[model samples]
Target: MPPPSAPDCYRVPTTPSSGEFRDRGSKFVAVLRPVRSEAEALAVVEEQRLAHPKCNHHCYAYRIGPGTDRWRANDDGEPSGTAGKPILGQIDKEGLSDLIIVVSRYFGGTKLGTSGLITAYREAARLSLLETVLAERVLTSPILLEFGYALMTPVMGALSQLGLEMADQEFTERARIKLEVRQSEREATVKELKAAIAGVYLAEVHDTFVVEGLTVSLPG
Candidate 1:
């Protein structure tokens, strides 16, 4: 098989989602939320813990950033791989990042085997994700361009023609415009802008972000 395409876009929940799964009398409630960082993800988990203080366990999994390298799965008090691993598996299966899923379990006077616990947590997470409204987020990099006031007209015209938005602008001795360009289009945009106006200073990209766009559906 050919190599997979680089991930320029990803799916993320538009709002919080909740679902429940009961097996062998044990109840598992899964809550899914969009998060941009590990700190945010942990805060969500803490909120759930406070809301369900009597629960027996609070297992969770989170994935951050564009690459799959930044991720974590916590079993909490459940068996080694039964809770967190299954929950994370569902998230990965849906090809989503920048999100977290937490499964809270309430003991139902019965103990579910390792396999049963895995299935229950996985099902709960899947159900929660299914109820969520997702959006396709495109990654963008910030570009700062500075030029003399004499070149303002041509620079603005070039930016408008290229369909780029100005995030910020300043008027001093020179004109400085901040633009958010899609990562894939950064190179071409810079080249075109330079060719359109002389003495255009294209600064190095220091930050990137993902912005939500149209709604998207995940494969079942």
Candidate 2:
């Protein structure tokens, strides 16, 4: 596991990808994508259904939010745990979240039974990941800092030392500055801010947001 000092990011697919597998006579096409919410994931599933209206089934699994706090797997008329579970297993195996994998099956007039179905779905999902591109998303926390005018020099020096730029600033009897700190830097940044302000200052850390397009390939 990456330490807290590491980038507070997670792995996710940046674009959609698909893979297929055949079993007996059935064709399974697995579509994998990153989705922001359960609503969006369901919408993608609907789109897949409409695009393949003739398919025998549309089994899927989706995990959303950090830690995969919300998730679901649907067998979609297939035997319990055969289709959806295996597909979800693939997603989990990749340590991915906020993603969906939907496998649409077109009956080829042969039944491979339960175990075969599981293998087909799992293989298709794995293949999708093989063709998928991955990215490390960066998370940012908004912080508000206020300090007495007397300490502007030290505060500015601290900001410079930390390579933190103010998102917004106000100067009056006291000064207030807003910043966007990476989640990984929050604790250390707070400590530095306190040290700089000394006797008089306020630093408020706010909710986090994803840094747009600020992606990297995290090292293992």
Candidate 3:
């Protein structure tokens, strides 16, 4: 049998999601938010801390970038490996990146043991992720084309035929257009466009990233 195909896309939360868990009168509130960078993740954690100043503990876990190399888990004041590890484990189990989860605990005049704390944190994180709407995003690279006005017809036609969308454009003595093509289609798109329009200048790729093309339809 042929080898299994590698994944070309990834799932990400469309918006912030929240969940709550209660045990032995203690309240655990989980907030899951999609973030692109470490700075953004830290900012969200700070925001949560400020919002719940009375909370006894504010523990968090975050994963950023395309792989697991960039990630962190903070136990805060909780016992070692009780809070943050469980929260991070949940994120890894869900196969999610570019996300941060904060679990704030308010002591309810009761002390839950280590096992209880772990279960509560993990379940809270799982519930928050379950409540999120996830989108499948594909990676893309941008190409900027600058050509003479004489090539307008062919240039526009080539873009339309390739089903590529122009991200930006400028009309001047020379027409300038920016296009984003899927990384896998980059070479083909450039070859087709160059063949259609002579003297089409291809600029360096300005940016490369992933984006959701359409909303996923969930089953009832």
Better model by lDDT, 1 or 2?
Answer: 1
- lDDT value, candidate 3, whole model: 0.78
| Residue pairs with backbone atoms closer than 3 Å in model 1 (clashes) | none
Across residues 1-220, which tens digit of lDDT does each residue of candidate 2 receive? 3222234787778889999998888899999988989999999899999989999699999988666568999999999999889998988888777789999999998888988999999998889888888776677777776666666777787788668898888888678788887788776666556544443333432223222221111122
Better of 1 and 2 by TM-score: 1
* Model 1 spans with C-alpha error above 4 angstroms: 1-6, 198-220
Candidate order by decreasing TM-score: 1, 3, 2
TM accuracy, model 1: 0.84
lDDT of each: 0.80, 0.79, 0.78
Q: List RMSD in Å for every model shown.
A: 9.4, 8.7, 9.6
- lDDT string for model 3 (61-170, tens) is 99886655999999899999999999999988877778999999988987899999999999989899889887756666777777766667777877776677888888
Candidate achieving the largest TM-score: 1
Model 1 C-alpha lDDT per residue in residues 1-220, reported as the tens digit of each score: 1233356676767888999999877889999999999999999999999989989699999999778799999999888999899999998888888899999998988777888899999999999998888777788777776667766787777777777788888889766778877778776666666554533334422123211221111111
Winner by lDDT between candidate 3 and candidate 1: 1
TM-score: which is higher, 1 or 3?
1
Rank by lDDT, highest first. 1, 2, 3
